[model samples]
Target chain A: MKTRIFSLAGIAVLLALCIAAPQMLDAYSLGVALQLLSWIALTQSWVTFSGLTGYVSLGHAVFYGLGAYVMALLWQSAPLWEILLGSGFAGALLALVIGYPALRVSGPYFVILTLGLSEFFKYIVIAVEAGLESSGRLIFGAPDPETLYYIMLLLAVVATLLTWGLARSRWGAGLRAIREDETAAETLGVPVTFLKIAAFVISAFIPGVVGAVWVLRTTYFEPMQLFSPTTSFTIVTMAIIGGSDRAPGPIFGAAFIVLLSELLWARAPHVYLVILGVLLVSFVLFVPKGISGQLAWLMRRRRA
Target chain B: MNLKSIALRAATASAAMLLAATAFAVEPVKVGVGIAQTGMFAPAAIPALNAYKMWADDLNASGGLDVAGTKRPVKLIVYDDQSDFTKDAAIYEKLITDDKVDLLLSPYATPAHFAIVGVLERYKFPMMGSTAASVQLKAVKPGNIWFPTSALPDVMGPELVKLMKAQNIKTVAISTLQSPFAQEVEKYLKMALKDSGIKLLSSVEYAPDIRDMTSIVSKMKSEQPDATFSLSFPGDSVLFMKAAREQGLSAPFQFVLVGPSAAFFSKIFGKNLDGIVTMGHWSPYQTKWPKAMPFFEEYSKRYNETPDYLDVALAYMSCEITQAAVAKVGLDHDKLRKEISSATFDTIDGPVKFDGVSNASTPTMFLQNQEGKPQIIWPASDATSTFQKKGPWAN
Candidate 1:
């Protein structure tokens, strides 16, 4: 029944998009909307790793950027769909490789190590060959927007589905346990290290794919674009703000943050960051469970 | 016979996929704008966007840009690069490959532009850039894909030396923000200062975002150089000026670069901006071109703001040259840019021509910032307002 409802809702959105895009959206607005959707996908995927397991990563852009660069390099040699799948697989492989060493560290040290690892990977792996082809899109690039938009829309749906599946799984519960009391979860034979690494791998996959698609959508990529801290930070913040554990949390947080930042941007740039800092502090101190948690609380009160 | 049919069938299948996805049938001439809308480049991007919008509107109004055979309307497809180098690099690739824009609008900001230009160089597209003075664009060698907007800071060393000698001004103090871009200026200008009898009073550098710069200005004052050449940006530039004024540390003659000048500087600082000078792109007082005024009127009316040195000189001139180039050599890509490089356009700056190596138009005028206004004064041939030295340059 839940799957039916999910499928129905997904179809409804896609139907609405197809119906509305030609009529309502100009090429420019579609471009912006597609970009916003890509970021949402990225942020939601971040929740699967850092939000659920309490493994805060400040350097997810390394994955996102690498995914983009890898796909871009592949794009020169292959087709768009191949690049998308390749980027996702590459991200997963990278996460699994790094996750072993990264999962060794516990508590705050793990977070710091993940951050440092991303930075190290960026300088060593990606930028080394970036100079080999410097000018222009590096290869036959500027993708048609209509195609990129459809690709991005499909990616967003796929990412959301992945998150939905994770939310319902036994692994999801295990991750929550790891977040709450890691020692207790481990004693229960939750395979805490393995689960954490899996979460990181799974979380990184969507962003990697999304990043590649995002480059296709925008038709541009460079080192700074892919590996920016802003990409990681924004995604992580959205997950935390919405409600880290639930499926709805990241979506709410992503939309809320993007909308808020856009409005703040029009007024004065950088003030939105201060507002984000305040929101984070307030949420941590007063509303520990996050925005979705608050919504759930209100619903329970109403039922009573 | 079977193998030939199979190869033909594969070609047809590929063509079918291309048609189904996005028709690559090039009917209208497409142009691409690869400006960074989100990242550190946003400030520079905003003005460039405005300039493009103005140009796009003008092109459309005049029945769009002319192609050789068909007068296809110009469409500028803009993409937000979101300040990711990888993303931007990807964007340019897609633009040239898929969208298949005939001309790609040059991006803003040095680092981003320099990176995106690689795609241009890779594809060998004629990219007219508005990035800051970077020797990397053309370097000592010339590439057809390369064109930069401003006079490279290397040019500043020789130009400033000439200005100082011409004015009999010597003993200069210099300061630049601790940015790679600003550092480039300092590196080149310091070398040029070597050839001149100008004694180095004191040269200082500051953090890109200095909270309080009074000490720096105070230190400059203590050195007591004949003139000060300070390089600053929008935020720090204004702060430095206000701080220097508050501290009563006034250099009689100061040349401020990459800071505030022209309308933006005037709108903000007004009379307090007096006695400042900057390397400028164009001077209204210097140009008598008929095409120049219409550009000013259209520019001022649309944006409701006056044009600046680079705005009038580089932005407008580049647009004119681009239009004239394509018009001269029908979108042949090969012949178009050489025509652009060789073709002389009477710009707001004067009879402008590109020196392929530096991508700069020689006989470029150095602007004087007098009483909070930018007026072209250098290159005496084009001088309208004789430079009146009031504070530091005053004897």
Candidate 2:
């Protein structure tokens, strides 16, 4: 009861800080905060599906790219809320279409297929844009950064809650069962394919919305840039660094990377990348459970 | 008083004067920019960065940048945007809101430039842009940012057709990179070709990350057109060049849209690079622009490599315009914007005057790699040398 109360209090404080960010922070810090929220939202969504199912995905960028494309297409023509909704729908629809076949495979094959499908979709978008003879797009008169920040904050909160809720649900347990022993879970009467697809679709929705909001920050969209593999790579890196085992892992991970980059990029851009590489290697080799897991272990030890 | 006492008094007085001067030296002007220090666009962006660096060095060497009557040293606040448009925009916002830089410099690439227009508008900051050209730039509201490049795709398209017509070339095959600038140029080129009654044998568009030009070059070879125009960026230009050479697709009037002017291109191709025409408006061989050769020589001497004829020239020219404007009206944003838009500043590319965001003075021109040197080959007035057909590829 004490632990639950403390957790609730911590979440409340975090929510307050996010709400006060636009009022308190300067433009640059607000931009950083927006970036942090975006990563948090994306990583949390990834954790909801990949963390629970043990089916690692390397193509979350596809949903994000699709969302941004939908935003670009419907930018000024539709209302702001409609554009965002349309973007989210585009991502969810794509996820639903790709999930059934994609979830059939497991482990490395699933990872590879997700990546391949992402690339295939990227080329398809490119070809579509080319056929239209539109090379790129720039969004004029995008809402100010402050407005975008609030939207991102909402997404981040919802994503975190969704992950938290799903992690404790019976559905999460069944997914974990599939991760441990798929045949046994199937024999136990778990709807493995349906659960996996649902999780995949749930994971994809937020990233899509996040991508739409992100593009407004730049107001420029090129297919190659929007669908870059680096986005996927960064998402996976954050998940690994943050510890994908818990609901709060993505928050810790996103904050760590964003703050570290903010502190170092201005001073030493290249060195920051090198340090990131070193940290990633160290985490994979030594601290396999990541920051959140390590923290949990420390807490248990203290109680003991 | 003894002679020793008199000498000591004189020395003390001179030392005191020196200290006072040091204390009173004007504060440096903080000019901020976010450029691609790493990632895909680095190869193209580094030249622009070098140009900015060279300009600062030269100004400091000559008693700093002239701010009205007083001379203030320039301190450039540079951030690496990593060739990401969104990151580039964020860096600009940081530079404006956090760093609080006094002046602004443009970032590299068309997309990065387009990304920051909102920030520029929001802050009412004026910047002189370089290395970015597109038809869409004209659509941007004309106050905060001005493009010094005369190589607008719409203009270049018709000019290219005129140049081809001048050389008596008829049938042409075109291949383009599916990038905004490249594709825009391709669109206009096709329109111009159609308008001018030039027969288009074939047209192909390749993805920006395309590596194999085997099929594209083969298709061009099969057509056997009189001219082949590869509207490509640096990386793809190299791919197209290699594929063309290996496949021996020797269209006499071959024009690669970009990448020939970079120092690496010549180093890579050497004699084979000769006779290939590329887009550029500036050259050292143009004696009319007296400052051109000296700027070229100084850049070459400082960097131990040849500057990109198009990007570097435009980058340095932006600095010149910025310096000239600052010298006229101190670092006031409104005054700088007005001066930049209205004033006819003398640049290495000759007199540059912006008429609503685009450089109205500099002519849209092309350059050819003639015997390992970039020579102006179009718009007779700007041509340092006449146009030439492609020679046989080196073995």
Candidate 2 segments whose C-alpha is farther than 4 A from its true place: B1-24
Tens digits of per-residue lDDT for model 1, A1-304: 7757986999799658754673577543555566667776787788777777887887678778778877767776776678888898888999999888888877889878877887677555433432242322333344655666777667676677777787778988898899899999999999998888898898888888887876654444545446666677777777778887776787678777767865674345446568879988888788777788899899779979
Query: Which CAPRI quality tier does the interface of model 2 achieve?
Result: medium
lDDT of 2 by residue, B150-251 (tens): 999999999999999999998999998888888899999999998687899999988777978989999999999999999999999999999999988788
DockQ of every predicted complex: 0.07, 0.75
Residues B229-250, model 1: lDDT tens digits: 7777666777777766776655
Return the TM-score for candidate 1, rounded to 2 decimals.
0.62
Cα lDDT of model 2 by residue, A1-304, tens digit: 8998998999899899889889999999999999999999999999999988899998899999999999988898989999898888889899999999888888899999999999999989998988888868888999999999999999999999898899899998988898899999999999999899999998999989999999999888899999988888888888888899687789888998999999898889778899999989999898788789889989999989
Give residue B14's error in model 1 in angstroms: 45
User: Relative to the unseen true structure, what is the C-alpha lDDT of residue A103 in candidate 1, on a scale of 0 to 100?
Assistant: 85
Considering just the first chain, candidate 2 attains a TM-score of: 0.98
Cα RMSDs of all predictions?
Answer: 13.2, 2.0
